[model samples]
Target chain A: MIGRQSILEADVDTTGINSLRNGPDDNGRFGIFGGRFVAETLMPLILDLEAHYRAAQKDPAFKAELNDLSVHYAGRPSPLYFAERLTKHLGGAQVWFKREELNHTGSHKINNCLGQILLAKRMGKTRVIAETGAGQHGVATATVCAKFELPCTIFMGATDVERQMPNVLRMKMLGAEVRPVTAGAGTLKDAMNEALRDWVTNVDSTYYLIGTAAGPHPYPEMVRDFQSVIGSEIKSQFAEAQGKLPDAVVACVGGGSNAIGTFHAFLDDADVKLYGAEAGGHGVDVENGHAASMTGGRPGVLHGNRTYLLQDKDGQILEGHSISAGLDYPGVGPEHAFLHDSKRVTYAPITDDEALEAFQLCTRLEGIIPALESAHGLAQLMKVAPTMGKDQSIVLCLSGRGDKDVESVGKYLGLL
Target chain B: MTTRIDTRFAALKAEGRPALVTYVMAGDPDLATGQAILEALPQAGADIIELGMPFSDPMADGVAIQLAGQRSLAAGQTLRGVLGMVEDFRRKDETTPIVLMGYYNPVYSFGVEAFVKAAKAAGADGLIIVDLPPEEDEELCLPAMAAGLNFIRLTTPTTDDKRLPAVLKNSSGFVYYVSMTGVTGAVIKSRGAVGEAVDRIKSHTNLPVAVGFGIKTAEDAAEIGKHADGIVVGSVLVDAVARSLKDGKATDQTVGAVRDLVAEIFSGVKRARG
Candidate 1:
């Protein structure tokens, strides 16, 4: 469905040796980063989901349906725009944008939601539940669930509910019951905890539409497969436009879905560099002050997988801080952990102030308002683009449109 | 190879009575009050104690235990502090088996090997790590079992018989059959189903089958105890502690609140097969 390759044939590292893309080996582990670290109550259900997903992966009808929905419903092949003004402003590399922002629901999240909701339908799940931080994923999920006519519930942090109000309203309009969770700093981690609790309680009829490339096994793998369309599109589109691969690719990391999606196709390309920008709230050096899990934290288990977590020495999960509610989670996906450890992908911390500056810069220069999450990638690009040769190019995944963030940006900039 | 958990369950089986297992968060409300509750549990008729090592995120728990962990963490509980409590409890009582129960991150953070050794040295009889299913036996269960600690596994209503063998393969101490397919503190949907589940699990392993998750009231315990080798009650006891708190600090009645509830539940356990 993505890039003229079947899910099994295209990415299969037959030797099982050195394909960075072929991760999460049979145990759902990405080199000790991901595993099914869940309770027994959820094990049978997780295993069942995995079985269904595997079956769905092989079934051509499932792929055909997903591809149809992707092209017709969500609008695939978002334009690969050459950001000429932004490149001129940077005064070095040619900056190209994979305009995931142009997709329906204004984000790359719809790509995954479409794929997962179809899987839920195939599995005969009666109800759908998801966790959201900035409400993009929630809205995307609600959109797909609405089209599919599945009853939907979304758990969002109370703090996020207040800050991301417009997106919350959007989810409501799309027919999702948004439950505000007030637990643990009222952020993404708490919302995920509540969602997992809900899944455990409603195991029989409910399908947990996890919003990130994290969680237990098959999720990181499944989400990457769904989102791989981003990178695959970038590959063919860039080849068509530029006649070669970009020197580098960039994406912001929250739970690292968009980043993983953008990076998966480029993993085997040794010439292409990958960068993931994580939220450095104030600073990573400041204890409990950032959401840059790989930059400031260690490997620990939470929310059903082992990954880099912002945690204290006692292993208690620290409530991570980030100006962008979408990037406020304490952990990144396990594949990112493996990538960080293997030194295949370079992950860096983008501070709140830096992201805000990039947000304004992109809005003015490219006339493209970026999501706060995607702005982190732009912040990283602002630093990297100036160092590269003018002929070299960097493709950044503009993961979402920034309309949902204008109010928060206005409040932050004293415009309100 | 017989752990304190095995000995205690064997003793309860010999007496033809279901073990009354009580769970109290290691540092709920405050340190001293939580310690007092731990010291008071055995005297109040709790045959086995599931000491909760409070973690920041307990995904499998309901609101009651979630709040208890929050209160404990707010009161400055850590994995080290939990082990210290176990050491302190061991100083007073030697027979009551203490199973450290909670999510895995805190223990994983403490370093699994070191935590297992420290837990064994500190007098923890077993572990009920809510997160580690049998697929991950090598992570902690095998190590803890290698160090002579009971690695108790939870068997849910969803764990069909086909998968029961794998779930029970590496499991030690006893088989914890969650009476329902939900988090802690929800009311059980059917009492008869629990009896049938217990019988189904008993068909597979000789390990004592303890049923938990929603055994709140004395009548609930009595009904469940009729089928299970042990009846585990937690959220209500933690809630009793929560109720007895004044201004979020432990009141004089905090320890006694949990003690009295365990006593009431024990009375039901006593009448289970009578």
Candidate 2:
């Protein structure tokens, strides 16, 4: 039981406006969690990249270019559809899905990719690179690179490359090179290491399009700004659909880009609750079996930012296990850590078996196959929505499509 | 509290020759073999010793050093055992500077303040924390400096004029100029460009500058010695240790082969003008 202040009472912006969204401060600290913890070799480039991002944030032309691509290329303003069958089945809260799974490249990842690819072009970078776990982010990046006519590379763990081979083929088909990282358990963390190595080596020509809302400063900040469009759209869409904000907003937390996007706009609304569901693999009670950073890990720095990390007493990061590859990361974003500490956001662990159950249930109930990453959020919704009144409404961020995860789920359930 | 790093650099300046800095992963192949290599380093003509604290995931490392660390970990080399190697080496040769080079996680997990105290007590001269940058000086760099241990900073090609001062601010004893942008082990091919970068760094700091990354042969060391105050060798030495092993155990020639290579590299530094 990690105790935190009741954010419902604390840090309330009385003006019905968001102050949490305006964070982090100039040093990129969301309450001492996010900061640039890189090597001296990469510091200048990071600083330079930060400067470019800051200037781009103010330039209307940059905004125009990115906004244009988001609408026409990636299909912006993904719909807010009321899940009638799901609501009826839950028999408690009214359910609506801010359908990010409908977006191009089949997830909310393209929202960030389009924003970053525009920035890369403005910076005159010729090549782009990124790391992926489930291959959603890699495909998004590869798609944007193909459209922008820039060469692209994606670093994926050897294990992921084999399991998510279809997405690997998708990236190669989209004219991007896919490199398999064979380090540390062959997962997301190892791929991130290889990507950073590539970024250091090719700093002059390559712009690293980080897929998550974690990493060194400017990244966590900027990626949030990019993905904030999700929340920004929901604010208006929910008002049009429900005539007001939903009672609660729920999203799955991996590296926490989608969750941040879902919760960023409603941060100032004290009436609306926010929930984040993290992967609890076998169980967090066992040593190194899960990815529930907030509930099961301690604060430490990794891959640039200080956040809750699943590491050993020796400070070595323990590899996270999840039936969903996208959520199989040992660390969460720094802002999520701040929210967890402040109690503005409630975080819970969703076990693999529970998520699998929700994955099947959502498909049958709503006729929508959800990505296993989003199934964690659905699992949490299944647990909590039944406890709420029928008049209350909850919005679940259906973060990605299930196509990339179908084979893995098939193998897991012995359906293959 | 004068650090051995400062003393060695000063002595090398007086000698008008570049210092030979050797890096070998502690507990590589096994603890006993790693200890033998450490004991033989100074006698093999190495002026400064860099003992790599073996880590499970060395992000900044290349294949050679990565394999060496794995070898050490497979032999059950914990952070304490690696530090003990430094303490054991101090018992015999206290003059040769020993810098513990590795990532920040092990020390962070060990607790920064406690790690610094133990490192100082163990006779470790300095640190080259690859992960913590100038922005995170509060994390480990400043504390290590206050404990009478030198915090050496690594400068690279991308470290521009604007960033050089910050990199050099808390840096003492020596500045490490990484010869390339990539991970360690990939050799620096452009000798002239590296020489100019070393000279550029010398213009900013009075502290000696040691150059590393890709100086594999004696010729490579002598050429880099023309520009640097110290020549640091890591990956090749680690690779030597890896190749000398048979079935994961150190063969009879493991320690001797590394010592012979270090002597040859040292002779190259000796041949170069100060």
Candidate 3:
């Protein structure tokens, strides 16, 4: 009973700060996580970026331009559909899917990409660079670069390029020069290292459009601000559709942009429980086998910020494994670290098998195929929904469409 | 309170010649060969040494240093192992200043206070953490300086006059002026621009300014040394170690190869003012 009371008290604002969304205080720190941990070469530029972003936030013209593009270009107000069959089959809580996959470029990645590319244009940056894992962010960034008439380069691990060839082809078709990095395990970490190398070399002309909600200070904050549209829309649509807030909201967390975005709005509503699903490749208990940073990692600095990372005793970052390349990184976003520590959000590891099962179940039951990244969230929902009462409701962010993952999923399932 | 870095730089200032600073990854290829490489530097004409504390991810470095770090990690070099190498090098020589250079994660993971105490006891004179800027001085820089270790900061071409003070505020030992806006092992776009940047940095700080990044050979060292207080070289020497390795293991020529390059580059530093 004492433990249950403590869990109830966790909702109280212990920091005396009013809102959970008011994080990454001036130093880019969210309760000792997230800071500008980049090299001195990129420091001044980062400060300059923060200044521009602050001004852009204040300017009405900037908001109008972003809003205009959101509706007319990238398809804002992505549909919120109640999953009738999935809910009935689970026989407990009602399930609702936030349709981010139906958006342009087939994922929530475009939300951040569109905002960043607009900022790049405003900064007069002639070239763009980004690192990607599953190629969703890469394809989204390449899509924006083509629309903006800027030359862009996408650095991807050789392994990711091999596994995600469909996205590789899509990026190439969108006119991005995809540079395959062969360093380390040839994964997202190596790709990020290569992209940083390129950004440092071409600082004067290039803009690094970070794909995730991690990285240095302004990037985490800026990316979250761009992605907040997800939660904002969910708030209104859910209110109108059900006449009340859902009991819980869940999303898949990689570097955690989509989760942070979806979690940002409901954070102040203490009654609304927020959940995030992490990639548990084999299992969190197995060494070097999972991407569940919050579940299995400790606080360490990597990729320009302090976050939970899968590293060894010697502080060497371990290359994490996941069926979904998007969630294969060793670290999670700093905000998620803060949220996890603050107990405002519950993050659980969903194994690859569970996610695969949920993937097939959602496809068969709802007639909607979700990205493997999103399948992790559905797996979490499968666990939580059955435990809740029939009157309760849950919203799961279907972060991307599974089109790009078809071949990989097919191979894994022996259908190839 | 004077560190070996300060003493060595002051001594070279009196000698009217820029110091030759050589860099090598600690425990690169293997521990024994890396120790031999460190021991040979002073005699090979290196006035100061920057021992690379290899990390899993060296983001600011180019391909050569990156591969060298991989080779070092593969050979099982831990942060503790790097400190042991420093202790071993101090057994024979004490005048050549050693600055441990790398990113901040390994040191942060080693426990900042304990690592500082261990590093000072290990006879390391200074630090050159590439990721830690002035904003993060509270993390390691101030603590290190308080414990009598010089915390060197790197100033790139992009660090403008307005931002130079904050960078130089907690800076001691020296200001490492990156000659260009790029990672290690790159070709310098203009030699003349490096001289100007060095002069600009000299105008702000009394600390000896050493220029690094993109400096590959003796001739390049000579030209850059004419304007700066010291010349720093790393990737090319690491590349020499790489080229000498046969099937990823160090050969007999491994130590000799780096010594030969250091001797040649020192020759250039010697003739810069002449």
> CA lDDT of each candidate?
0.92, 0.88, 0.92
- DockQ for model 3 equals 0.88
lDDT of 2 by residue, A91-171 (tens): 999988989999999999998888888889989999999999989999999999999899999999998898888899999
Tell me the TM-score of chain B in each candidate: 0.99, 0.98, 0.99
| Interface RMSD values for all candidates | 0.7, 1.2, 0.6
Clashes of each: 0, 1, 0
Considering every candidate listed, which one attains the maximal DockQ? 1
lDDT of 1 by residue, A1-416 (tens): 22212252354433235677667778999898999999998998889999888888878888889888888888887999999999999999999999999999999999999989988998899999999999999999999999989999999999999999999999999989999999989999999999999999998899999989999887888888889899989999999998999999999999999999899888889999999999999999888889999999999999889999999889999998998999999999999999999999999999999999999999999899999999999999999999999999999999999999999999999999
**Model 2: how far residue A73 lies from native, Å:** 1.7
lDDT, model 3, position A249: 99
Clashing pairs in 2: B187-B214
Q: Regarding TM-score, does 2 or 3 come out ahead?
A: 3
Docking quality class, candidate 1: high
Q: What is the lDDT of residue A217 in candidate 3?
A: 84
Error of 2 at B23 (Å): 0.9
**Residues A1-416, model 3: lDDT tens digits:** 01100110123334335677678788999999999999999998899888877776665577777777777778987999999999999998999999999989999999888888888988889999999999999999999999999999999999999999999999999999999999888889889999999999999899999999999988998898788889878988999998999999999999999999899878888999999999999999999999999999999999899999999998999999999999999999999999999999999999999999999999999999999999999999999999999999999999998988889889889998
Of candidates 3 and 2, the better by DockQ: 3
lDDT of 2 at A138: 97
Q: Point out the worst 10-residue segment of candidate 3 chain A by lDDT.
A: A1-10
For candidate 1, what is the TM-score? 0.98
RMSD in Å for model 2: 3.9
DockQ of 1: 0.92
